[model samples]
Target: MKPVRFWVGLVLVALGVLGILDATGALETGGLLSGWWPASLVGLGIVAMLSQRRMSIGPAAVTVIGLILLAGTLDLAEGGLWWPALLAVAGFAVLAGLRREHSTRTPLVMFGGATTREQSRHLRHTDVSAIFGGSTLDLRQARIDEGATVDAFALFGGVKVLVPRGWRISLGGLPFMGGLEDKTDSTGDLPADAPVLAVNGTAIFGGVEVTNTPEK
Candidate 1:
């Protein structure tokens, strides 16, 4: 997390505490979320910080800070500390996320992780010359070490595989369409022989394509 993000996170947490106290009639309302809201925000901030990469620091803080600012703004938009501070912190975070997202073309070769609640990523295999999402997908672009491949185990985001015109492939699994696989878009050439690879995950809004079963 950026130094600003970390400090913003800290301040948010403090605000949450104060909000809780205020909701319980211990402190002034000062315009903020109900007491419980801060607790939820604190948890989110912590998670974003932990999972955030160098490029994801700003966006990572968005969910938490955005929400907190929204709360404070709603309460104090007309006046008080929240008016300017809310605009500054929340706006800063948004710009940070946008800038990060806009500049993210470095190509992530390996990405994976997890948490209790939610997570996600947007990977395009078409842009990838090599793929190793746990298994191994290699070629000249891959076999010859021509391109880069991302190897991961438990990724939460959507995967977009971009294959050559006639690249053949196979993965072990019963030919059944279901779950996050989004069968309507699953396509891959599995030669007569291959191993079964089971894939189970949700498609928030994207296509899931499989070349085919791994050759036996």
Candidate 2:
């Protein structure tokens, strides 16, 4: 189900209504919503989790971070706790990522641009990271027997993914002050077990786009 945008829109509308009510003196939302802005992060994290078939680190991290901030804001926990917790989580993620094997390791593009094109007949997994730069992953020539997964991270940068029209794309990720654009053709006629490519990651102040546009 394509419920990502639906839920996001619903939340925004609810917030707007609350604001209007507060402005009209119909509600004392200011007192209720004070320091509650971080709930948006928690909601987005939950939405991301629901969108995916399995658990993912990105959404889990987002949720945890949101909870930490909410606790601090509500005076339920020390404000100093968030920093150490964030660092620990980030360290764990980095170490975990290093242990995984991929067809290509195209991580860390800082202040530049990088492109990785994989033509493996049995492609399995790959990852991309763009920080203050841009990155592209072209899997148009790759053949997947069962499925493949791509982990993408874009911070103050952009990522573009090129895939073949024959493959089914499952896009799941979190976008914070950023966007995730899916330009792939529909797979309405594909079989239930058609070769799938699962793309997941986080875009912070950047964008991650998946396109099936044919090469010139």
Candidate 3:
């Protein structure tokens, strides 16, 4: 599936074009298209759901709840009923996280600092969390296996990831009152089928930075 931003941009562009045409009296949607504007949320939810390689309950719940809210917004259902459904979806995501088989060997730094440098041939999946502290993860000496994902969470703290050059990287996640930076250099050539390293998660009142480094 394509990136969520791509689909969202396409939707926004289409809406802008339609609005322009309507203003010029070149086309008539009769307000029908305007009434269905909430469909954009539904489209984004679908993109998020399909972007996951494994079936994740979080994305699935988001998709279903988004559709419900979209229906309510379109007057096809009661908008007042959305809250309870949203709460249920949140609970489902929590439960699914607990039941997931993936390793939970997350590196955590609380009120302190930590640095991790693994020499493993293949880095799989990892999670890093920092609260009122800082953490650095160096992967310059490690080989990333295909489909590797690194989930980083920072709250009133900071996290840094140093990746080797020539690695393909994709980023996702949310930043609120904080920032996420990709300072990786793109001067080196990378293969089309190079292993993928996905960096994602949340940064609240904190920051996460990913930078490329020379191989060690």
Q: List model 3 lDDT by residue over 1-216, tens digit each.
A: 345446656887988899888889999865757576667756655665455444344244435656676666577666565766677667655655764456334566778998888565767876666777898888788787676887776767998888888788887676757888888987778888888889985565789888876225
Stretch of 10 with least lDDT, candidate 3: 53-62
Error of 3 at 122 (Å): 2.5
- How many steric clashes does model 3 contain? 0
Point out the higher-scoring one by TM-score: 1 or 3: 3
lDDT of candidate 3? 0.69
Taken over the whole model, the C-alpha lDDT of each candidate is 0.34, 0.73, 0.69
Across 63-83, the per-residue lDDT of candidate 2 in tens digits comes to: 666778787778866647767
Candidate 3 residue-wise lDDT at 187 = 76
Clashes of 2: 0
Candidate ordering by lDDT (highest first) = 2, 3, 1
**lDDT (10s digit) by residue, model 1, range 47-150:** 43343333233223334455565556456445565555557566645655565443322222223311111111322221111112222222212221122222
Model 2, stretches more than 4 Å misplaced? 79-121, 125-143, 146-157, 162-206, 211-216
Model 2 — which ten-residue stretch has the worst lDDT? Answer: 52-61
TM-score of each candidate structure, all chains considered together: 0.30, 0.56, 0.52
Q: Which number leads on lDDT?
A: 2
Highest TM-score model number: 2
- Where does candidate 1 stray beyond 4 Å? 1-34, 55-79, 87-184, 190-216
